[model samples]
Target chain A: MSRKPVGNAPRREPIRTRWIWGVFAVLFVLLNPWYFPAGSSRLVGGVPLWAWVILAVCLALSVFLHFVCAVYWQTGDESDE
Target chain B: MNDSGVELAFAGASGITVLVAYGLLMLGVGVITWLANRGLHQSVDEYYLGGRGLGVMVLFFTFFATQYSGNTVVGYPPQAYRVGYAYLVSIPFFITIILAYLVFAPRLYTLGRRLSLVTPVDWIHHRFQSRALTTVAAILMLYALANYLLEQFVAIGQGVSGLTGGTIPYQVGVVFFIVIMVVYSWLGGMRSVAYTDTMQGIALLFGVIMLLVGSLMYFGTPGDAAAIMAANTPEKLAPPDGPGLLRWLSLLLLVGVGAAVYPHAVQRIFSARSEATLKRSFIRMAYMPFATAGVVFVVGIIGIAAFPGLDTAGSEQLVGRMASALANQSAIFYWAMVLLFGGVIAAIVSTADSVLLTFCSIVSHDLYGRFVNRDAAQSRQIMVGKLVGLVAVVVLVIIAWYPPATLYQIFVLKFELLIQVAPALMIGLYWTRMSRRATLAGMVIGAIFASALTLAGLRPLGLFNGLWGFLLNLAICVGGSLLLPPSMAEQNRARELTHV
Candidate 1:
């Protein structure tokens, strides 16, 4: 069985990945109702539009993240290493 | 809005029959799985991890069901209703589990492959040769997991009773699910549970979508909800202020860290066919909060306007209330509502099956296989585990019937105990200096302090959870390691192990 190399000095991933996480963090922060006036909304189809918009945004983000995960992330086989 | 007495009876019968049918089908899956893999029954690897051949989809849904079931559906909504905007942190907190996994996935996956570890306890045993520490961590995990399983069992009983208008008593509902869960889990082991989880996950997703559409058609939008809430109680719409902000941030940290270390979850990691599959599954999982948490949050917010002034118990029944209201509408809406209710039941059972399987695997693999019957054949160990699991379900079902307020207290204890293994998991992956004695000391100290603080109702000032326990747990893990010395042989072993 193979083991992780010692003193390999955790290799830093590209700054681009950090940027991606940063963007997601910020979006999540904003997507929550913390910035909006509470209990405040104009009606659209008998529901609060802002809340629906937030839900839509959240759904969109989830789908987007799923796509990215499916496409971009790769887990290399341990046997090869 | 009181319909004919006959209508009520029909609805009750329909609900109970549908739930019973679902349970029977789940049991059938378990039996079939057992027959298919009967030859492999003697191997610990095959029974616990399905020969470690679980694919991405099966692996993904299993993790999905484990994470989102009882708490996500039942526990979270009331919190959203109560706290309003602040509790939205529950969504991101879930997402954070995936983010947290990225930190150690690369190394842990490699190490897990190298060691052929079955449970997280095995990883500890491999890293730290101290049997005492290993035993303590195992006991703590078993206790926490049992409590967690009991919580799900209680939810099954409450959910059935509430959904069926109390026609079926809580005791019967608990027994029905518990028996079915045990049989299926005993037969197929992980494979049976994973297959059922995939089905349950799909059903749950469908149910949530249907409910979302139904709510939109009935109640209008968030704006409408806001108008109603504003007219009745404006406070429900306002962003959280003062302690609320602090509470939200605390929730994000507490749940994110606590949930990632769940034993069932760790076991799933070992079941993955490859590192890529695990990583891919997590990446997709990072996004699930939107469907599960976001949808549920919206439902709770809508409840603020749709059904105002419900006290705590009534509020807890928010989903059921909305479904009943929808069912009373047109024929199409009525059938759809019933399906959604059935789907919820399916989700709950799916979670119960997975938990029961994990509970059995740990007992069979760790406690019984390691201690009581070290020389027992693989088939014998599996049988012992299954028997113990059946006994556990019966006892837990009894507890579920009455259920103490301390359920939540016991529930929270799971995370604290599970997190005790984190130092070993994370540190042992990289640091060779971590002595077996020190690691053992930290786990023991962590478990005691966490349980003590929890029992004493000790919270860190304004925070909602027992972070104090964690603080001490971490301190002991890090501090004890520094104070103790690693043996020369152990050091050499660790170095050799990591020398890839």
Candidate 2:
């Protein structure tokens, strides 16, 4: 109870969080296997090249998000000051 | 399935060495814990909860290990392999955990500090003033956690068998890590788990990076992978459509919410050293999916072209088979392959240690101290918790040895049960009107519904998971709270506590 609030104390906005999550949800819908054409692909070395690309993109995106989170999203705790 | 003589011997020797090393480390951890907690600071708060002093890095990694280990590495690849692009949902779903926390964690963190809340049950006990509700929530949390620990045990055995090419028997692998984990967890409590998680997390990251590099070198680029997939099966590259899209979205919702509520994870929030540390760590963790999920997904996708026509079981073995193939190709590849194998084992141990610690804390803090021996000294509570943890590990190892059914199926069941606690943790954070009775009723009904549907092989319409049970759970929690008025005393307490 002794803790004082910090920062601009961004107005509690559940809606904004919900919308951002919605965007990710939409992206998830766009990314799955149902849209892809079914059948076998010829092997390169040993794998399908497109699949590898998707994996790379995912890896890149995940790393990018972690950096963003580390740098931006975090607000210091109230107890720190 | 050919068991070459030389390969078998090499695998056996490596496997034994890894298990022995793991055992010694765990025993060492236990001894450290005993020494640290032996005298003046032997309270439950110090031992079970690490004196509530975890910094952001330790807190984040502890949470990360609990969520990502075992299944993130072992089970997820096969899913990615089977569903192809649809499994891309895994990364976003994981990122959603931080997003979900943003919804209420700040408030909860503040509240936790003020109340000295040791567990999620403490929050419930304070908010609702209902013993029945707190008890039910505690039992449900215990069941979900034990089931989760059991799955880790099962994974340890399978991971060891696969990594070693069956050179280590399943029973030996299960017992080996279980013994190690129990010893260390009993030693330093959360401190030991967190310290070791830092080590485990680093190994998993290094191993996965090495695997990705090795895969690209051995196979080729995505362009190459794409050309191969296009010729063999073009559908693997296409984006999801219709029901596939629906299922993907459902997966995102189910796992995002489900994973965030795990008892172990909630406990980590309590362990944070300062609010700043928690925030910094989360910001860092918000991006971990790239290293953890991103790497596993790449490995799975590459498997598409590298090894084709694999059945479900065969697909699950993709990482191991791919590693084995590469190692056999050259001397350099062989050593790199062994490191990757070691990394995978490290990931499993890291996960097991964290789960075991959380499991012990729950028993010590919630069950025994709260119910059985209410006035027991702090040291006594720690003793009961550690003993319960040791017993639980033994039971789980027995189950792992026999393995009543499939590993993945049991793994899925763990999430179904754990996700039931979401309403109480996520919703109760801000909403003062959420009555304890209502929360309990919703959780119980949801748990029963989820368990029944899973056992009956029922999927609500065409949804891929039993989290449909959660829908009912949420509805009951919301509806019951609104309908049943909170006692005046309860309302006053909530207002006083949550006031900003």
TM-score of chain B of each: 0.93, 0.93
Summarize candidate 1's per-residue lDDT along B111-141 as a digit string, tens digits.
6777888888777777777678778878877
Worst 10 residues of 2 chain B by lDDT: B1-10
**lDDT against the true structure, each candidate:** 0.72, 0.70
Mind giving the per-residue lDDT tens digits that candidate 2 earns over B449-482?
Answer: 8887887778875674447878888999999989
What is the CAPRI rating of model 1's predicted complex? acceptable
TM-score of each: 0.87, 0.87
